[model samples]
Target: MQRNTLGNTGLEVGPLCIGTSTLAGFTETYGYDVDDERAVETVLAVFDSEVNYLDTGNNYGKDGLAERRVGEAIRRRGGLPEGFVLQTKVDADPVTGDYSGARVRRSLEESLERLGVDHLPVLALHDPEFMSADQDGFGPGGALEALVAIRDEGIADHLAVASGSVEVTQRYLDTGAFDVVLNHNRFTLLNREAQDLFEGARDKGLGVLNAAPYGGGMLVKGPAQQPKYCYGERDEAFAASALAMAEACEAAGVPLAAAALQFSTRSPLVDSTVVGISRPERIRETLALLAVEIPPALWVELESLRPDARI
Candidate 1:
């Protein structure tokens, strides 16, 4: 994998980044539990791999367990790789749902302690669009304001906006406080809702991260097996489109996972594609998927088979 400059952060990152949401054991979301040993081993695998970027969140588990597992791996290795980039997002208090400036600061501090790091390369205000105006984030004494202060304090190298809503993300980018933008499940094979958001971020010299190329599992697991897009039950038509795409890939002698992954990796708008891994084998599988020889005709057919409406 070739390394590329991540916007103006002066950091070099590969086209793939390891996401730790599932590694934290979100059984309800992924329908599986990742034991502590398994999660730590997975991070160790990533450290030995070619990819140098990692993404985690403050509330990825019951108590930021994902970051703790990552920190454990780092401890065994003595430290982070020489040029590794570790990014984590801030979340509202799980108990009180407070996203105030003070809460943002506390969330980051907790993340640092969990990851066993004093500073971060990038820190994102995660999922702020879910809150209303003048509260949680983007208002007076909100999380967004604290993010800027944190960056200014040299606690974090750069700031990022990682949200699902395209319009909400564009609004954050417009503030010009963010150096990177990350959107998941909205730019995958079955969805193009983030197209304009990516375009705008690219034009502004901000890093673009396209996460969840698998549409939360359907594209790779096969519609018959997964039957969901982004872990949410979609309309029958959406499931039908996924089924057709899986069949198309089969006819073309390609793995549906490869097409789904490369759909984000091969795009010009994306600097990195975030993939979740809970097991050690996934490290090698993801790399193999990246190397698969996808025929050009398969891309054409997949594009044509895109849902008439975005999921």
Candidate 2:
């Protein structure tokens, strides 16, 4: 329930943010379901726990179904907390996969309508990699222009870029336009490339929101036994390394999920760590873990199990 100021955005948010990617229909990719009623309950549980920052996106579903669900949940509860903050991502066209300035404007307008809000607290570029060719989209007369316009018009309070690659993240940071940066896969025990980006964001005074702290569940389940994405295709050496980390957590009496969430927030570079939940009970479990402080000795043990150290 502790709050931290997100860089210089002047907005205070809880250390734990509720991510709505799964509720928006990205569950198959993460292996979950889009149960609206349950999702609403989870959001409510988050509020009850004093974690009011909710992260979502425009491209989360067929339209803005995820945003709508979030809006409905807040509305059903009478209203959000006095200072509750809602953040969401805006993506380029889902069909063409182009991230142009026009697409950015269109996406934001659609998201606002879906969320039933005139303005959003934070608006992040959904996928940085997808906008590689359109880095100019964030330049003058580009998507950045639209984002700035939205903020100026009171449709958004802050702008941010959520990316997987450190290089892509740097491009946005250099622009001096974004107030936050949501990073994925970089700060995990499996991949630390995002560590550099985190440093940069902190130095530049940009709020750092670490996503995929569990490496898309790989860390939670101890690296998928089967190969798929970069993290999933871990060879015996990598699997052994990940298992060792899991064992270390067990030996230290820490649940893998709890370790993942706590580890991400422990870093000074991370202002908040977003956790995606499909069920209401998961929210309670996360809150319980957050309330328990991890011993320093246990943290050192967990750090020692990092992949680089195993080799």
Candidate 3:
């Protein structure tokens, strides 16, 4: 439960952050389901723990239902404790697919309404690949422009970019517009493509939130239980490689989940590691995984098993 300063933002967060994507019910994006009562319980459990950071998004579920659930959890608690940080994303328009500055403003307004908060400590532009990479999103009157306005207005303390593509992520980071950069399903025990981007972000003095340390649940569930890497079904080669890593963890007396979580948090490139959860038990399990120790020899064995793509 120790905290780390998120680069130049001066925002302190735990090494482990609880992500709320699963708080929304079944969704095609994440392919998971959790009822309302359970989702609330899970979020409350994280709040009650030593963890102080919560990550969510506007498009986490159909029509941003996940944000509402998170809001409900806060309302149930009467109010969030002092120093607690809530982070969320302003997603691309569901219908128009626009990420213009105006769209960014509208998205934030909706998010604030749903979450029952006037402002956010962190607000990121989620999935920029969905828009025009050059002009529409990053140019004049672009999404970044709107984000900076929000920060200056005291509506959002920090602005960041979270993307599934390392190239897209690095481009935003290099602009020097965002305070933090969040890249997921990469920089894990199985993938290192984000390594270069992480280094670049650090050099620019930007914070790094390495998400999906479990490789979209594959590292935790193992290839046998979850055959997919990232969001797609794994190919035969990746399947074999993942299975081999699982076997290595088994033989070394280390849980693959523990190895993945530790591998992400231990890196100098990562300021915080984000893990998603659906139920209260999963929070406890993630905490246990974070506490479990991994041997140095096991890391050497893992270096030879890294996945190729950052996604």
Candidate 4:
């Protein structure tokens, strides 16, 4: 329920942002169900809970259906909160794996029409690796140019890049264009790359939004249930580490989800963490977890269980 400023953009976001990727079936790209109604309900509940930040993307569905659904939900609710912040990603080409300047412009225009918003609170480049691989295709002359133009024209309030790698984040930081960065699974018990990112973001005055705080459900469900879109496979050592952390949480009377959400926020560099909610009950569960603080001794134990190296 705490709020933090998003870098220098003058935007205050909740500690837990609502992630809409699952709502659009991105999780199902491997094997998950598409729950449009439940997704809308979740968003509504998030707003009701005073969590005003929503993160989505244009390529979430066949033709920006996810953005449309979010837009409709806000409209049906009469409108979003007075100072609510809506953030969405731009993918160059949904059908083909192509990212270019022209595609970026087209995507933003279409997203605006679908969302029924004149300007986006925050716009992020979907994937860091893809953008780095084709810098020209996504660089200033390309998508970045379009994004800056939009900001200048008052079509977007700020620009951001959502990535999964430290290297990719550093590249964007070097450009000095992004106002914030969205990172995934970097600061988890299994990885500590976030430490470096935190330092970098602080030095550059960029706000950090930590995604996949639960390691894409692995931390919540445990290793017995493998994550659908995980970057690596689960092994015995990884399973052991996860179990140790889970047991520590149990012993300390703290839910793993609570630890996950609070861990990132404890870092001064991290502004917020995004948690996906499929059901209203899930929101209550997460909120309850958020209310409990992880003890210092418990944090030390949790850190001891971290993997020595990345997978």
97-164 per-residue lDDT for model 3 (tens digits): 77789989999998988888898888999998778654477668988888888999999998889888
lDDT of 2 by residue, 1-311 (tens): 68899999989988888888768776446665667888788777777777778898988777777788888787888877778888888898878876777888888888877777777889887776776564577566677788878888888889998877778778877878889999876786666888888898899898999987777666665665322223344456656666777787787788766777778887898999887777778777777877666778877776777777777
Q: Which residue ranges in model 4 land beyond 4 Å of their true spot?
A: 27-31, 131-135, 138-140, 227-232, 309-311
Better lDDT candidate (2, 3): 3
At residue 229, candidate 2 shows an lDDT of: 25
Error of 4 at 11 (Å): 1.0
Lowest lDDT block of 10, candidate 2: 225-234
Q: Estimate each model's TM-score.
A: 0.96, 0.90, 0.95, 0.91
What is the alpha-carbon RMSD of candidate 2 to the true structure?
Answer: 2.4
Worst lDDT 10-window in candidate 1:
130-139
Computed on alpha carbons, the lDDT of every model, listed in order, comes to: 0.88, 0.78, 0.84, 0.76
Point out the worst 10-residue segment of candidate 3 by lDDT.
302-311
Question: How displaced is residue 11 in candidate 3, in Å?
Answer: 0.9
Better of 1 and 3 by TM-score: 1
**What would you estimate as the lDDT of candidate 4?**
0.76
